[model samples]
Target: MKIGIIGSGMVGRAFSIRLAELGHDVLIGTRNPIITLGREEPDSKGIPAWKFWSLHNPEIKLATFQEVADFGDVIINATAGAISIEALSKIEKDSLKDKVILDLALPLSYSPERSPKLIYSNEDSLGEKIQRAFPESKVVKTLNTMSYKVMLYPSLLPRQHNAFISGDSEEAKLIIAKIMEGFGWESKDIIDLGGIITARTTEMYAPLLFQLSKIKGHYNINISVVSK
Candidate 1:
């Protein structure tokens, strides 16, 4: 499958590399071509070269946002929550019309001292907004509840962790589930928590993740759903 990822941050880069490693053709969409080429270095304090190198591979190519949208069979949105709608608006909606998008973004706004806070209300969410904006596209909300490291490397955990996908389209969710499995997740580990409306709860997990990262001094933590 050809996958295009918007936002070249940790989540975008990590997902691109992992999917490519699983034999999927991956393309990353970045706001600036120079940054994608590593010509314009990212802030060293926020993202180190070694970490970037770990997520970037020779096989993954970078493209303009429009090109990525047109080229992908599935598009993954890994952008900052606050600007996600704006970033996507730059792309021609017709290009992504009817495409399956795996939305890993949360509806969070920037904060001076911490990761962004969820700015969306209980009645709406990033996923739902995307779906509404591009009614032709199918948006499946997944991978937002966990940290970037655990998004693809769940086995590194002490035990298996649960990943959730929420969307109205069953077929799209199934396709995303297969892709998730290829990234080293088991079918049993993925939970479909109903339609896109459920994204509110999933997005809320971002704050919990932020707090956990602070307490654990790590951003690699994950959650598991256990049976009684």
Candidate 2:
């Protein structure tokens, strides 16, 4: 599979490297290749510069937002929540048509306050918005509830924790679920929350995730659903 991932952050790099290792063709999409490659400073989260990361990762090529959208058979939205919609706007909607979009973004509205607010209401979510924005594309929201490390490696948590999935198309969800399986998520542990609207439920967990990481001093954690 040829996968184009938007955003060159930790999540994007992790996916690009792992996906390339899985023998898939991978290209990382950014607003500007030169700028993305020229930055020497670490990101706010202290992740190393993309330029530094790219040198060690020659297997994954880089492209503009539009080129990636055109090249990928599957597009992964790994951009920051605040800029996800805007970043995607660079792509022609026609290029996104009928492709499975594995969306791993949360709509976070940051203020000076400690806790950032979720942009969408319970009736709507980033996943639903992406689906509505590009109705022709099949959008599946996954991997947003956890960090890049845990997302690519669920066994890091121990004990059967889960990865939740939400999307309108069963086929698209299956495609994403398969990728999760490749990431070491068991079929039984990958929970389908149903339709894009349920993305609100998963995404709403962001604040808890943030607080939990702060409390635990790590992002290597996850939640499990237990029901009879």
The digit string of per-residue lDDT tens for model 1 on 43-126 reads 544664433564546677778899999999999999988889999998999999989988988777776887767887677899
Cα distance off (Å), candidate 1, residue 91: 1.0
Candidate 2 accuracy as lDDT = 0.89
Model 1 misplaced stretches (Cα beyond 4 Å): 34-38, 48-56, 113-115
Over 143-224, each residue of candidate 2 has an lDDT whose tens digit, in order, gives 8888889888787886888888999999999988888888889999988889988988989999999999889998887888
Q: Assess each prediction's global lDDT (C-alpha) against the native.
A: 0.85, 0.89
> How many clashing pairs in candidate 1?
0
TM-score of each: 0.90, 0.95
Cα deviation of 115, candidate 1, in Å: 5.7
* Model 1 residue 127 CA deviation in Å: 0.8
What's each prediction's clash count? 0, 0
